[model samples]
Target: MSGTRATADLAARYRVAVEADDPRVLIPLYDPGALLDVHVPHWRFQVEGRRPIAEQVCVLPRPGRFTTFDGEATRDGLLVRFEWRQNGPTGDALVRQLHAWRLRDGRITEHLVFCAGVWDRELQQRMAVEAPLVRP
Candidate 1:
């Protein structure tokens, strides 16, 4: 398969893993020494190796919590935009994030997450309209 097609396939599978909320399913998608860089508005850190990456994935909000996942193949990786919702004491909250992954030999070598902060309802609606989610 061509590199673009391959990455698109990988991106689809990655979305499946995320929606499944199963670390076991997600772990194999990464290289043994994979690097995950997490960058939010307030915090930034890196997780190295599959073990830690799996651990991080395990702690994410469960399946169905994420409302949408839109992705496309990049020259060297995949770029996925995700919208997630959570119910808290206050009320329902939404978060929007972008994830970029670099794959090598069909496994992810580098993954980066970017998010500004929790998104308000108006912003979420605008984003949903502007960048509607698409499956592979």
Candidate 2:
């Protein structure tokens, strides 16, 4: 557990943990009674406890591997914004997410997430042609 928390970069920890597909790597990063509040579209759900949060995070059906992740540390905690996508013949599914985590005692006590929902290649193409973004 200490091994996982040795580094101060939380986003690096996440990249390692997710890439390794190891939930144990994140268990120590959260408080025993950690809270996770997730919001997607018009839906919201909550999960409590470190073990549950760790497990839940690992099982999330992200589009695929993360495309990008950026973390901004704040006085109380930090915010991580990232995207996931899988480009292949099957389809190119993309999902965007943001997480605001409050840390204390080197462990996260609260985590709030906002998900933009999933978009397949078709939808992505339509949106791109219909409404092009001036900025990425």
Candidate 3:
């Protein structure tokens, strides 16, 4: 498959993955030897091989609905930026992030996630004023 087709397929895959909350659709979307490099303030997981990555994602505890917006795609890859509102046991938290993807042969070979921490100080301050009850 061409890069363009791969890019288009990625967007569709994400939609199916999130909407169905099924890792099945997502797992096959990547190359057999794909790599997923995820970085956060406290944790870094450089998962290699599609099976492991899919398993990891499958274990992700679902808190609430996930929404994706402001998506863009190119011949090289696809970019999916979105906000996810997770209603945890304690309260609800909103996290926004931009996902940079690299597709090869209609499959995602590499993926990097840039997280916009929702629990940041600035967000807390804004939440305190806007929605105190939900603010942590």
**Best model per TM-score:** 2
Off by over 4 Å in 3: 1-6, 58-61, 118-136
lDDT (Cα, tens digit) per residue for candidate 1, span 1-136:
9887777777777767666676777788899989999998879999998878967854553323778877888777788898778655545567778999998898999999887677656676787899887952
Q: What is the number of residue pairs that collide in model 1?
A: 0
What TM-score do all the candidates reach, one by one?
A: 0.75, 0.87, 0.74
In model 1, residue pairs whose N, Cα or C atoms come closer than 3 Å (at least 3 residues apart or on different chains), thus clashing, are none
- Candidate 2 per-residue C-alpha lDDT over 1-136 given as tens digits, one digit per residue, 9 for 90 to 100: 4423432477688767865668899898898989999999999999998888887776545436887887877777888888878766678888888999888877789999899988888899999999998997
Q: Candidate 1, 56: how far from true, in Å?
A: 1.2
Task: State how far residue 23 of model 1 sits from its true place (Å).
Answer: 0.7
Superposed on all Cα atoms, model 3 deviates from the true structure by an RMSD in Å of 4.9
True-vs-predicted CA distance for residue 13, candidate 3, Å: 1.8
- Cα lDDT tens digits, model 3, 1-136, are 6556557667777666765677677888889988888876677778988767766544332565665465677657788877676667756667766778887777789888777565644576797889878533
User: What's the true lDDT of residue 70 in model 3?
Assistant: 57
In model 1, where do residues sit more than 4 Å from their true spots? 87-90, 119-136
Name the lDDT value of residue 69 in candidate 3: 60
